[model samples]
Target chain A: MQGKAVVPATRRRRPSSPDGLVLLLLAVPGIAWFSVFAYGPMAGLVVAFKDFNVRDGIFGSPWNGFANFRYFLTSGDAVTIIVNTLFLNALFLSASLLAGLILALMLNEIRGSLYRRFMQSTIFFPYFVSPIVISIMLQVILSGVGGSGGALNNLLSVIDLPQLSWYTEPGAWPWILTIVKVWQLGGYTSVIFLAAITAISEEVYEAAAIDGASRARMALSITTPLLLPTLGVLLVLGVGRIFFGDFATIYAIVQDNGILFPTTDVIDTYVFRSLRTIGDFGTTAAIGLFQSVVGFFFVTAAVLVQRRFHKESSIL
Target chain B: MSTTGYNESLLDHEAREADKPAARRRARRRPEPFTVASHIVVTLFGLFCLIPLWMIIAGSFTDETVLARQGYSLFPNPFSLAAYELLFSGQSLLNGYVASLFITLVGTILSVSSTASLAWVIARRLPWISRPLTVFAYVPMLFHGGLVPLYLLVTQVLSLSNSWFAVILPILLAPFLVFITVSFFRQLPEEILDAARIDGAGELRIFFQIVLPLSKPILAVLGLFYAVTYWNEWFMALLFVSDPDKYPLQLILQNLIANVTNATSLPGATAAQAAAPVYQLRFAMTVLTVGPILLAYPFAQRFFVKGITLGATKG
Candidate 1:
C-alpha cells in the first residue's frame, strides 16, 4: 500500500491539462484583465521621473528624477487638494460615525424586531441608490427659483422664508455633502455597529443594573466601554482612506462646474481632469503616485496603531 | 458570552417583583421608551429616505412647466403622461433600454462567475502562492497608475477600444468582488471539500458540483453588487463607446438630462421649448434607471444585510 501511494504521489502531472490547470485557468482571465487595465498603468507612473514628452514615449524619455515631486510641492494646488480632502473626509467620517452610532444604539434598544428591520432596510436603500441619482435629486431640490425645480425653495416658501441658491455657492457644499454622506451611509454603518453591540456580554449590562443604574447610565458606563474596540477599529479604517475621496459623489455633484472647485475638488477629480481633458498624463500620474504614497504611509501607521491597541480582540 | 450580562440585567430589573406585581407588569407592559422612540425615529427617517423617490415618481407624471413651478410636490399636479409618451415614443430610448438590459445581464453573469472562481482558488491555503496572490490583488486597491496608460492598453494593446468588451472586461475582475468572495468561501466548511475529494471526485468537479451550489447566498449578493455597478456605470461607456446605439441607459439619461437643463436655460428658448416635456423625461429616466434594481432588491435584500455584516465582521 505504501509503495503504491508513493508511486501515485510522485507521478508528475501535466501542468497544462485542463483539470490540473484549474487555478491557472481560473486566474488567467482575471490576471489578464488587470495586467492590461490596472497594472499596465504602472508604466505611466514613470512619467513623473521623466520630462514626459508625447514624442519621447514613457520609457524612452530622459529622466529628470525628483523634479516632478519638487514641482508638486511648490504648486499651490497641492496644498489645496490635501487640505480640502483631509478636512472633508474628517468631517464626513465623524458625522457618519456619530449618526450611525446613535441610530444603531436606538435600534438595538428597541424591542420590536419588525420596526427595526424595516427602518434598517429603508435607511440602507439610499446607499444602493447610485450617486448619479442622488446628484440629480439634489439639483432639483436645491436649485433656487428662477433656476429650476427648487423643491427646497417651495418648502421654504410655505414657511415664508427666503430661498437659497445652493449651486454656484461653495460655502454650503461641504455641509451638504456631509449630510448626503450621512444619509447614504448611516444605516449601513449602523449595521456593523449593531452587530458589535449585539456581541456585548449581557452579563455586563446585568452587572451595571445590579449597581442600580438607569438605562442611560448603563449605556454610557457599560455599553460604550465595550464598544470602544469596534469604534477604534472603524476609526483606524476610516483614517486609512483619508487620502481618497468618493470619485462618484464628487464627479456627479460637481460635474465640470469649476465654480465648486475650491470646496469639492478632490485629488481624484483633479487627476482625472488633468489626464482626460487637459491631456497631462505625466502630471496626473505624478499626483496619483503622490496620493498613493501618502495613503500607503498613513494606512500602515493606522494598521500598526490598531494592532497595538487591540492586539488580541481586533478582528481585522 | 454576553448573554449572561443580559440575563443579569433582567434579573436586576425583576428584583422585588412580588411587592409591585402590578407596577412591575406595567413597567414591563408599558414597553421601554426606547421602543417608541426607535419606531418614531426610524419611521421619520424612512419617510425622509422615501421622499425623493416619491418626488421623482410624482414629477414623472406631471407636465414640465407644472414641475418647474411646483418643484416636485408629493401629489401630482396637472398630471400628464407626456414624458412617458415622449420616452417610449422615441426609438433611441427603446434602443438604449435594450442595450442597458443586455449589458447588465451578460456582464453580471460573466463577472460574478469569473470572480468567484478566482476567489475560491486563492481562498485555499495552498502553498505560498495564495498569500502572494492575495497581496497582489490588494495592491491595485492601494495604488494604481492612472487612466491614460489603462486607456492605451485597452485600446492599443488589447484592441478592444470601441467594443462592448472595453466596458465589460476591466470591471469583470474587480479586486473588491474577489475579496468579498474569498472572505465568503473562507467561512465554508473545509470538510465538505475534503469529503468530495475522498469520494474520488476531481477538484474541478468538486468545485462546480459541490462548492458553487452551496455558495448561492453570497453569489446572489455579489451578483447584485455587480449588476448595480454595471447599471450605474456611465463613465466607462462615455470614455469607450461613441456609438449612440451602444450607449447604455445611464449615458443616454446623462445626455438627455444635461441637455434638457442646458436647453431650458438657453437665452433664446421659448416657454414651449423650455417646457418641451424635459422635466418629466428627467424623472422618467431616473425611474427607468432604478426600476430593475428596486424590483429585484426586495427578494435579495435579506441576503444583503447578512452578507455585508458578515463581510464587515470578518474583515
Candidate 2:
C-alpha cells in the first residue's frame, strides 16, 4: 500500500500544491488560536477609549474619546507608576549586564573543567525556581523584629547594630530587587556572553599572550572591547522593555503588601491590581493602551537601530 | 563558531584534564593573581546561590520555636517534622501537585507541537501564506491588547474562569520560540528535502518522517522552555483560577507565603498564630514546590543553556 501510494505521488509530483494545502491545514489551529486569543483581545483594546461595563460588551459600550486617557494622565498614579517601571527596569538591566559580563569573563579564564562546571551549575541553579521561592527562602535571612528577626538581623544584633525591617522598608526594595534579579539571571546571561567569548577564537588570546599581555590586561583590552556589540544590542533591547516591569518577580515577592507598593509597584502590577482588585476596566485599559503604544514605539526604534547596526540581526 | 561552543569547550576541557599532567598544570596556573581572584569570586558567588536554598531546607526541618529564636541555622536545632506533618495532613498539596503536573505535561506538549507546526510553515516561507502568517504571529510580540481585555475575554467572554484552557490557551504559541525554531528548521539540508520531494514523498510525510526526526534537539530545548514556563505558571492562575483545589503549585506557594507573612507580621499576634508552625511550613512549602525543578536541572541544564543562547545571542 505504501509502495503504491509512493508510485502515484511520484507520477503526480506537484511540488507546491499538496504541501502548501497540508501545511495550511497544519497551521489552522495556531492561526485560530492567535486570532481569538491575541488579535481578539487587541480588537477589544477599544475598551481603553470606552466607558467599559461588563453588561454592555466592549463594542456596545459608550465611546468616551480620550476621557480614560485624560483621567489616567491627570491621576497622580501615572507618573509614579511609569517612573517606578523605568527606574526599576533600569536598575535590573544594568546590574544584570554588569554581573553577566564579569561572571562570563571569569568563567572563560578557568580552563579546569570540573570546577568551572560546578560553579556554572551552582550559579545557574537559581534559574530553576521562581522568585517567589527565592523571596520566601531569603525572607528567613532578611526578616526583622516585626517578623521574628532573621539571620541578617541576628548578625546585626551580634555586631551591636540595629535590626532593620527589610520588607517594610520601601527604600531598601529597589536595591533588594536589583540584587535578586542579578542573582537569578546573572548566570544565565553569563553563559550567553561566555558563548560569544568562546567563539572569539583561541588565536586572539594566544596572540596576545605571545605579545606579553597579562591575562587581566588581555581580558580588559581584548575581550571587553569585543563585547561592545552584544552589550549595545542588549541595551537597546532593554530600552524597548523599559516601560514594562518584572510583574512576576514583584508580585510573587511583594504579594499585595501595600507597604512596599510605593517603590516596588510598576505599570504591570498597577494594571493587574486595577483589573483584578479595583475592578476599574476603563482606567486600567487606558493605562494598558498607553503602555502598549509607547512600548510599540520603543520596540520599533530598537529594531531599526539593530538593523542599522547589523542588517541580518533585525527581527523586522 | 558552531552554536555548540560551550558544550564542545567543556568536552575539550575534560579531555585535556584527563590526559595532561595536573601537577604541572596547577604549578603553572597557581601563581596567576587573576586566576586566584576569579576562582575565589566565582566560588563565593556559587555559594551565594546555594546557601539560601540550603538554609531554607534546614529551616524546614527546624522546630518553629527554634527557628523563631535562631532565625534559621544550618543544622536544625531540635529537629521536628511538624511542617511535613502539617503539609501531608492536607489534600490541597496533592491537588496542587496534580494540577501542576497535568498542566506542565499537557501544556508543554500542546505548546511545542503547535509551535513546531507553525514554525515549519514560517520556515518554509511559502509565497502566499507564510508572510501574512508571520506578521500575525510576530505582531503580538510587540503590542498586544492589554490585560483588561485578556482577562475579560478569558473570564466573561470565553467563560473559562476555572478551566485549565484559560491558562494554557493564552500562552499556547510564542512568536519568539516560533522564530527561533523557524531559523533552526530553515538550516536543514535542503537537498534531502528536495530528494524526498522528487521521490514522490508528500510534504507531510517528509516533515513527519525526516524533518521532525532531525529537529529533535531544538524541539527538546523548546519543549523544556515551555515545560519550565508551564510549571512556573502562577500569574494566569491568579487571574483566572479561584478554586483553591485547582491552584497550581506556584499560586499555592504564593498564597501560602502571603498568609504566613500576614500572620507573622500581625502586631501582638495571637497565641494560635505563634504556635501555627508558620515559619517551618513556609519553608517546607517552598521546598516542595521547587523540588522537581531542582531535580530536573542537571538533566535539563544543557538544553536550557542551548535554548537561551540560541534565542538571545543569535545574529
Candidate 3:
C-alpha cells in the first residue's frame, strides 16, 4: 500500500480536462471585466488619431492622422508641462529616497522594539491620509485669509519675521510640493527598505562584529551593500515613472491657483484641464497616448536594464 | 506559522545572542553617541508627523473665535462642539456619509471577490490558461490606453455617468491588487491542494472551501486597502458624477473646502458664516472625512505592515 501510494504521488497524473474548463469558467468574469475596462480602452486609443465627434463616435470618426498630436505639440504649453512633470518627479524621487533611507537607517539603529514600532506607525500614518485633506490642512496652516492668523504666519510674527503669502508664490511651490511629497511617502517607502534590512541574515553582522567592526562600519559595509538590490530595483522603477506626475497631489494642492501653475502644472494636470475645460477629446487623447507610449518605453527599457544587471530582481 | 511569528523568532534569536556572556554582550550593545542622536531625531520626526493630525483635531474642537485668534493650538483653551453640531445638523453630511459608506463597502466586496477568484485561477497554473491570463493581467500595469478612452468607455459605452457605479467600477479590480492576491495565493502549499484534488474535491470546492478559508489574513489586508482607497476616492466623482446629492464624502468635503475658501472674499451670508466658523468648519470636515479610518488604523496596522512586507519582498 505504501509503495503504491509513493508510486502514485511520484507519477502525479495531469488534472482532468474538465478541471481545466472549470478553472477557465471561474476566471471568465475577471477576464470579461478587464476586456471591457482595460483592453477595450487600449483598442480605443486609436481615437487619438481621429477627430472624435459625438455624432461620429469613437471608431466611426474620420481619421485625422496625427492632427491631434500636432495640435498638442504646437500648443507651446507642451514643453513647459512635460518639463515641469519630469523635473518635479525627479526632485520628489531624490528627496523621497534620501528621506526614506535616512529614516530606515535611523529606525534600524534604535534598540527598543516598542519605540521602533510606535515611530513606524506614527510616520506611516500620513500615507493613508487623503491628498484632499492634506490640501485643506495646508490651507489652514498657510493661507493668509482662510487661516486668518494662520499657523505659519503666527509663528513668523512670534519670531520677528515677515509673513509671506505662501499660496501665491509660484517660486516656492516646487519646494513646498517636494517637501509634502517626501513627508507623505518617505515613511511608507522606508518600511520597504527596513524590511530588506531585517531580512539580512544576522550571521553576517555577527561575523563582522567578531572581526571588530563597529555598528556604523557594519551598517555601511554590510547592511548598505546588502540593501543595494532592493534600492536598485526601487530606483529603476522610480526613473521609469518620471513622466507620470501624481495627479491627485498636484490637482488638490494647486487647484486653480494660476499663479502657481508655471511651477506646479504637470502633464497630468495639463491633460485633465484640457479635457475638462476645453472639452477637446481628440487633443487630450493624443496627449494621453503620448504619455502612455513614452511611459511604456521608459518602463520597458528600465526592466531590460535591470534584467541585464540583476536578472533575479527584474520584475518581468 | 505566521510570518510575524517567524520574524519574532528571528528577533528573539538575536536578543538571545545579545544576552550571552557579559563581555560579548557589552561589546554588542556598545553605548554609542549615534544611538542617542538617532532616538532624538526619530522622536522629533515622529512628532512632526503627528502634529498636523493633532492640529486638525484641536482646530476642529476649538471655539471659532479662539481658533481664528490662536491659529490652531496643541490645546484649545476654550473648546467647543459647534463644529460637530453643524456637521450633525445637516442632511447633506448624513447623505454624503451614506453614499460613501455604500460605495466603500460594496466596492471592497466586489474588488476582493473578483481579484481573489481571478488570482486563484492564475496561481493554480491550470493547463493552457495560466500563462496567457498572467500576460493579460500584467498588460494593464505596463500599458493603459490612458484616461480619455477609459472615461469615454465608462460614460458613452457603459452609460454609468452620474451614478455611484461610475465611482465603484473604475477601481473595482486594480491590477496591483490582482498581482498581490496572485502572489499570496501562490504561497499556499501545493501538496495540500493536490491532496484535496485526490480526495475528489472539485476546483470550485477547493477554492471556496479550502483556499479561501486559509487566506483570511491576506484577504483582510487587501480588504482594508480597498476600503481605504474607495473611501478616500474623489477623482471618480470629480470626473463622472455631477449630481450634488450623489456626491461621496470626499467630493463633498472638497467642494465644501472650495466654497469656504471662495466665500472669504465674496460679501454675503456665506462670507458672514465664513468669518469665524469657516476655520473650524474646515477642520471639522477634515476630521469627519478621515476620522473613521484613523480610528480603525491601529487595529489594521499589523495587517498593513504584513501587506507591505509581502508586496516588497515578493515583488
Candidate 4:
C-alpha cells in the first residue's frame, strides 16, 4: 500500500500544489499590508508633479511639471537645510554607536548577575519613553529661567556664567540633541552589541587567558575584532537613514523656531513645515522624493559595503 | 514545584561560590580583583538612568509655584498635587485617556494575533511560500514614501481622517511586529506542526488550539512592544485628528506641554507670580503622562529585558 501510494504521490505531488498555494497565500497578507500602508500613499507623490491646491485635491491638482522641483532646488535655504541635516545625523549616529558600545562594555564587566540585570532593565526604560516626553523634559531642563525656574541656567548662574536661551540658540542645539539621542537610545543599542559580545565563545577567552592576555587586551584583540561585523551592520543602517530624520523628536522640540532652522531643520521637518505652513505640497513632495531616492541609494551602498566586509553575516 | 527547585539551585550556587577559594588554591592563582574604576563607571551610568525618572517624579509632586522658584530639585519642595489636579480637570483629558487605553488594548490584541497567525503559516516552511513572503514582509521596514503621501492615503484616500480608525487601522499591520512574530515562530519545532497535520487537524484549528497556546513567550514580547508603540503614538493623532476629544494621552500631554512652553508667561497673575517658572509644568505633565507606563514597567521588566534582547539580537 505504501509503495503504491508513493508512486501515485510522485505523479500527483499533492504537497507541491497546496504548498505553492500556501506560499501564495502567505504573500497576500504582507503584500496587502505594504500596498495599503507603504505603497498606496506613493500615488500622492504625483502631487509633487502638479501645482497642488487643496481646492483641486490630491489627484485633481493641476500639473506644474518640474516647477516644484525647480523651486525646491533654487530655494535659498535649501543648502543650509540639507547641510544641517547631514551634519546633525552624522553627529547623532556616531555618538550613539560610541555611547552604546561603551555602555555595553561596561555592562559586560559587571560582576554580579543581579546587578547586571538591574542595570540593563533600568537603563532601557528610557528607550520606551515617547519623543514628545523627552522634548518636554529637555525644554524644562534647558529653559534657563532663573530664581528656581531654570535648571541648567540656574547651574550656569552659580558658576557666574550667563544663562543661554537654549530654545532660541541654534549653536547649542546640535550638542544638546546629540546628547539627548544618545541618552535615550544608548541603552537600547547596548543590548544589541551586548548580545553580540556574549555570543563570542567563552573558549576563545579561555584560550587568550592561557596565553597570559589581560582582560583589557583580550577585549581589544579578540572581542572587538569579532564584534566588528555587528557594528558594521549597525553603522550601515544608520548611514542609510541619514537622509531621513526623526521628525517627531525634532518637530516637537524645535517647532517653528526660525533661528534654529539652520541647525535643527531636517528633511522631514522641512517638508512638514512646507506642507502645513506654506501649503506647498508639490515642492515638499519633491524634497521628500529627493530624500527617499538619496536614502535608497545610500542604503544600497551601505548594504553593499556590509556585504563586502561581513559577507553572509551582513543583513543585506 | 519549579519555583522551589529554582531557589534550591540558587542556594546551591551560593554554596559552590563559598568554596571558590579552595578551588582557586588548586589552580595556582586567582583572577585579578575586579577593577574599582569599572564599578564607579557602572554605578554612575546606572544613576544617570535612575535620576531622570526621579526628577520627573519629584517635579510632578513639587508645587508649581515652588518648582518655578527652585529649578527642578531631586527633592520635592512644598509638594502639592496642583499639577495633577489641573491635568485631570478637563473632560478631554479623561476622554483622551480612555481613547488611548481602548486603542492600545484593541490594537495590540488584533495586531499580535494576526501577525502570529501569519507567522505560524510562514514558519512551517511549507516549502513554496516562505522565502518570498519573508522578503515581502521586510521591504516596508527599509523604504517608505514620506509622511504627506502616507497621511493623504490614510485620511483622504482611505477616508479615515479624524476617525479613530485612522490611528488604529494603519498601525494594525505593522511590519516590525510581523518580523518579530516570524522570528519567534521560527524558534518553534516543526514536529509539533507536523504532528498536528498528521492528526488531520485543519490549519486554523491547529493555529488557535496548538500554535498559539505554546507561543506565550513571544506573544508577551510582541504584545508589550505593540502596546507601548500604540500608547506612545501621538504623531498619528496629530496628523489625522483635529478633534481634541479623539486625541490620545500623548497628544493631550504634548499639546499641554507645547502650550506651556510657548506661553512665555503666566500673564493673569502678578509680576512675582508670573516670574514663577512655568517650564516645570511641562516636565510635570510629561511625568504624569508617562506615570502609568513607569509604574507598570517594573513588573514587566524581566519580560522586557528578555524580549528586547531576543528582538534586537537576531536583527
Candidate 5:
C-alpha cells in the first residue's frame, strides 16, 4: 500500500514491463520540445562570446572575450536601449495597474449587469486585436497629413492646434506606447481585478451595507485594500521582466523608424535590428545576455517575494 | 486545498455576476457623486477604446477618395466596398486567409494537446520524471536563452526556414499555461483516478476518457489563448518564413501597411483597381484581419476571465 504509487498492481505482476517507464511516454513530446527549442538555445548562446562568421560557423569563429560587450558599451547604444526599456516598461506597468484598478472599481460599482457586461465587452476588444491591426489604427489616427491624415490631425485642426509628424516625434512615443499598452491590456487587467473583487466575501459587503456605508466608501476602503495582494503579485511578475519589452507591439508600431528609436527602441528591438540589418550576431547576442542576466536578478527577487506571500503555492 | 479555494473563487464570481437579480430589483436610491463619476469615467473610457475602432469601420467602408480627403471619420457618408472587393479578388489574399486559418487551427490543436499532456504528467507528481521537467519548463520563464540562439537554431540548425512549423514550434508550449493546467488537474478528485486504476483502466485510457472531459474549462481557456496567439502571429513569420505563399493574414496586412505598393496592389488587380487603394484598403484589411477575433472573443470571455483570475489569485 505504501509503495502503490511507485508500483502499480499490474506492473508488479509483469516484472519485465515497467509501468513507470511506460507512464513517461506522456511526457516525451514536451521533453523533446523543451530540449530542442528551450534548452537547445541555451547551448547556442555561446555565439555571444565568439566573433561568429558565416563561413566559419558558430564554434569555429575566434573567441573574443567581452569585445562585443565593449563595442555596445562604448557605442553608447547600450545605456540608451536599457534606459528606454526600463523607462517604457516602468510607465506601462504603473499605468496599466492604475488604470486596471480604476476600471475594476468602476465596473464593480455598476448596479446593472447588462450595462456592466457591455462596457466590459467593449473594452476587452483591443486585447484580442493583433498588433498589426493596432499599428494600422495608430497610423490612421497619427499619420498627420492633409487628405491622408487620420482623426487626431482633424481633431487638432478643429481645435486650431498645429499638425505635427507623429511618426518622427521621439518625445511623444513614450506616451503613445503607454496609451497603446493601456488600450491593449486595460480591460484584461481590470477583468482580473474584477474577479478578485467578485471573490471578496459577500458578507463583508452586506455588513457594510447594513451599517449604511456608501458604495464609494466600501470600494475604496474594502475593495482597494483587498486587491493589494493581487496588485503585489502582478507587480512582482511585471518587475521580473523589466529588462524585456514586447517586441511584437513595438516592432509592429515602430518598424525601422530611426527617428523614433530614441524613445521607442528597446532591448528586444535593438537585438533584432542588430541581427537582421547589421548581421552582427556577437553584439546582438551580448545585448541579449545582458538583458537575461539582469532580468534573472529581478526574477530572483520576484520568486523570493512570491515565496514569502504564497509559500504553499509559489507560481514559479 | 489551494485549488479548491481557487476554483470556488471562480464559482463565486459566476454566481455573483449572473445570479444577482435581487440587486437589480432594489429600490432606486439617489446616485452619489462617486457613482455618477464612475459612470462618467467608465463611459468616457469605453468610448476611448471604441471610437478608434468605429473610425476604422467607417473608414473601411468609405470611398478611397473620401477617406483621403476627410481622413477617417466616425461616419462613412459615402459607403463603398471597393477595398474589400479588390482585396478578396486577389489570389494571394485568398492564400493568406487559407494559411492563417490552417496555422491557427493546427497550431492550437498541437499546442493544447502537448500543454495538457505535459501538465498531466506534472500534476501526477511522478517522482523521478516530474521534478526535472518542471525545472526545464520553469527556467525558461525566469531566464530566456536570448533570440540569437533561438533564431539560429530555428533557421540554421532546425532549418525550419520558410516552413510553417518554424512559426508553430517555438510557441508550442508556454510554461505559464502548463502550470495553470497542472494546478487545475491536481485539483481533480484523486479518488476518481484511484477508482479507475482499481477497475483496470490504463493510464492513457483514464487520461482520454476521464481527465480531459473533466477539464474542459481550462482546455477552453488555453485553447482560446493559443488560437489567438497563432492567429495574431506575424513576428515569427517575419523571422522564419520569407515566402509570400506562406504569409498569414496578419503578415499580409503587415506587409500591406508597411509599404502599400509592395503586396498591397496584389498581382491580379488592374492599374485602375490598384490605383488609390492605400488609405481605405488598409482600413478594410484591418477590419477583415481583426473581425474574426472580435467576434470570437466575446463567446470565450467568461472562460478567459475565469482562467486569468484563477491564475492571478492563485499566484
Candidate 6:
C-alpha cells in the first residue's frame, strides 16, 4: 500500500501546475499591502529631497535637492539629538542585556517549576502593559504634586533623605529612563534567553555533573558559553538598532519637559517635535531618512557579521 | 505515581553503579547553597516587578484627600471608589473602551487571517512564488521608509487619517508575525500535505479544511499577540487620528493625563478640576486599560511560551 501510494504521489508532483497560480493568488493581498505600505513609503523617501508641500503633494512638491538634509545636519541641535539618541539606546541595550542574562541564569537555577512560572509571569506583566499606562503609573509614583507625593519621594522623606524632583531634573533622566527601559523589557528578553538556555540538551549538563563540576561552575562554564551565540545574535541586533530611540517611552515619560530635554531628547522625539511644532515636512523627512539609511547599513553589517561567525544563525 | 517509582529505581541503579570502585565520579543530586541564593534573587526581582503594579492598584483605591496627604502607599489609608466612579461615569471612557474593543477584535482577525494566508502561501514552496515572497517579506524587516513616509502614505495616499482603518491597516500584516507563522506552517508534516493533495483537494480547500485545523495553536498564539498589540496601540492614533470621539483607550488615557497636567499648570478654574486627585484617577485609568489583558495573559501564557520558543528556535 505504501509503495503504491508513493508511485501515485510521484506522478502527482507536477512542477508547473495551476496550483502555483492558486498559491500566487493566496499571496496577493499580503504582497499588495506590503507594496503600498512598506515599499511605497520607501519610494516616498524621495520627498525628503523635495520640498513637500500639502498643495503640491509628495511628488508634485518642488524639488529642494539637499536643502532638507543640509539643514538637519547643520542645525545646532542635530549633534546633541543624535548623540542623546545613541547614548540612551546604548545604555538601555547594555543594561537590559546584562539584567536579562543574569535573570535568565538565575531562573534556570530555580528548582520548583511553579515558583519559576510565577516569577516569570510577574516579570512579564509590564511588557504587556502599554507604555502610556506606564507613563501614568510613573507619574503617580514620581510626580511632585501627588497626594502620596510620588512614592519614591515619600520613601525618601521617611528615610530622612532629601526628595529629588525626578521630572524636572535633566541629569537624572538618563539613569531613570534606563531603569524604566530595563524594568519594562528585561523580563521579556530574559524569556528569550531562557528559551535558548532550556533548549540546551540535558545530556551536556549530566556529563558535566559526572565530571565533578559544581552546579555553579557548570552553569558558568557550560551554560553561559553555550548561550553566547544566542546572546551574540541579540547583541548584534541591539547594536544595529542603537540609532533608533524608543519613541513611545521617551515621548510618554518626558512630554514637552524642556528642562529635561538635554538628556531626554532623542532623534525620534526631535523629528516628531519638528513635525508637530514647526511642520517642516522636508527637514523632518530628511532626519527620518538619515535614521533609516544609517539603520539599514548597521543592520546589514550585523547580518554580515552573523553570517561570518555563525552561518546557521544569519537572519538574512 | 508510576513515573516517580521508575525514576527512583533508575536513581538507585545509578547510585549502585557509583558505589563500584571501577565506576567514575557521579553527579550530586543535593540542592546547593547557590539554589537558595537563586531563589532569593528571583523572589526579589519578582517583587521589584510586582510592586509598582501593586502600588498603582492600592493607590487607586485610596481616597483623594488621603492620597494627597500621604502619597502612594502599599495599603490605602482611607479607601474609596471615587477614582473608579469618575472613570466609569464619563462617556469618553466608555467610548474609548468601545473603540479599543472594536479595533483589537477587528484588527486581530484581519491581521491573523492575512498573515496566515501569506505565510501558508510562502510555506508551501510553490514553484515560482516562494523564494521571491520570502525575500519580499524580509525586506520590510530590514529596511523601512521611516515614519515620515509611512505617515504620508497613510494620510495622503491612502487617506485613512482619523479612521479606525488608519489604526488597523498599517499593522495588519506585520513582517515579524508573517515570518513566524510561515516558519510554523513550514514545520507542519509535509507527508500530510502530500496526502491531502493526492486526495484531490485544491490549495484553498486543503488550507481551509486540513491546514487551518492543524494550525489552531499557532493561530491562537498569533491572535493573542496581535490582540495585545492592538490593545496597547496608541502611537498610531496619536499620529493619525485627531478626533476626540475616535480615541482608543490608550490615547484617551494619555489625553486624560496630558489634560490634567496641562490644566494644573494654568492659573484658571480648570486647575480646580484638575486638582481632583488626578494621580488616583490616573492609577484607576491604568488599571481599567491594562486590567483585562493582564487577566487574559495567564490563560494565554502557555501558548505564548510555546509560540515564542518555536519562532526563536526555528528562525
Index of the highest-lDDT prediction: 5
All candidates: TM-score:
0.87, 0.92, 0.92, 0.87, 0.94, 0.91
Comparing candidate 4 with candidate 5, which one achieves the higher DockQ?
Answer: 5
Q: What is the DockQ of candidate 6?
A: 0.39
Query: How would you encode candidate 6's per-residue C-alpha lDDT over B1-315 as one tens digit per residue?
Result: 023443344244223422321221235567777666878988998888888888888988988678766666789877788878767766667778888999999999988888999999888776567878989999887788888888888998888898988998888888877878887786666677677666666777878887887777779889998999999998888989898878888987777667765533221214347566566676777788888887898898766666666665666
TM-score of chain A of each: 0.85, 0.92, 0.92, 0.89, 0.92, 0.92
- The docking category that best describes candidate 6 is acceptable
What tens-digit string does per-residue lDDT give for candidate 2 at A55-158? 99888999999999999899998898899999999999999999999998887667677778779888887877786787786677788223868888888999
What TM-score number comes out for model 4?
0.87
Better of 1 and 2 by TM-score: 2
lDDT of 1 by residue, A191-296 (tens): 7787677666565656665676655565567767787778888898899889987777777778888888999888887877776787766666778788878888
Q: Please tell me how candidate 5 rates in CAPRI terms.
A: medium
What C-alpha lDDT does candidate 5 achieve relative to the native structure?
0.81
TM-score of chain A of 4: 0.89
- How many clashing residue pairs appear in each of the predictions shown? 8, 0, 0, 5, 1, 6
lDDT of 1 at B54: 78
lDDT tens digits, residue span B51-169, model 2: 88988888889887777665668898888888887778777778889989988999999999889988888788787878888898889988988889898899888999988777788
Model 3 regions lying over 4 Å from their true place: A1-14, A144-149, B1-30, B261-276
Q: Distance (Å) between predicted and true CA of A182, model 1? A: 0.7
Better of 2 and 5 by TM-score: 5
Candidate 1 overall lDDT versus native: 0.71
Pairs of residues clashing in candidate 1: A201-B2, A202-B2, A202-B5, A202-B6, A203-B4, A203-B5, A203-B6, A206-B9
Task: Give TM-scores of the second chain, every candidate.
Answer: 0.83, 0.87, 0.88, 0.81, 0.91, 0.86
- Identify the runs in model 4 with alpha carbons over 4 angstroms from their true place: A1-30, A144-149, A308-316, B1-34, B125-128, B261-281
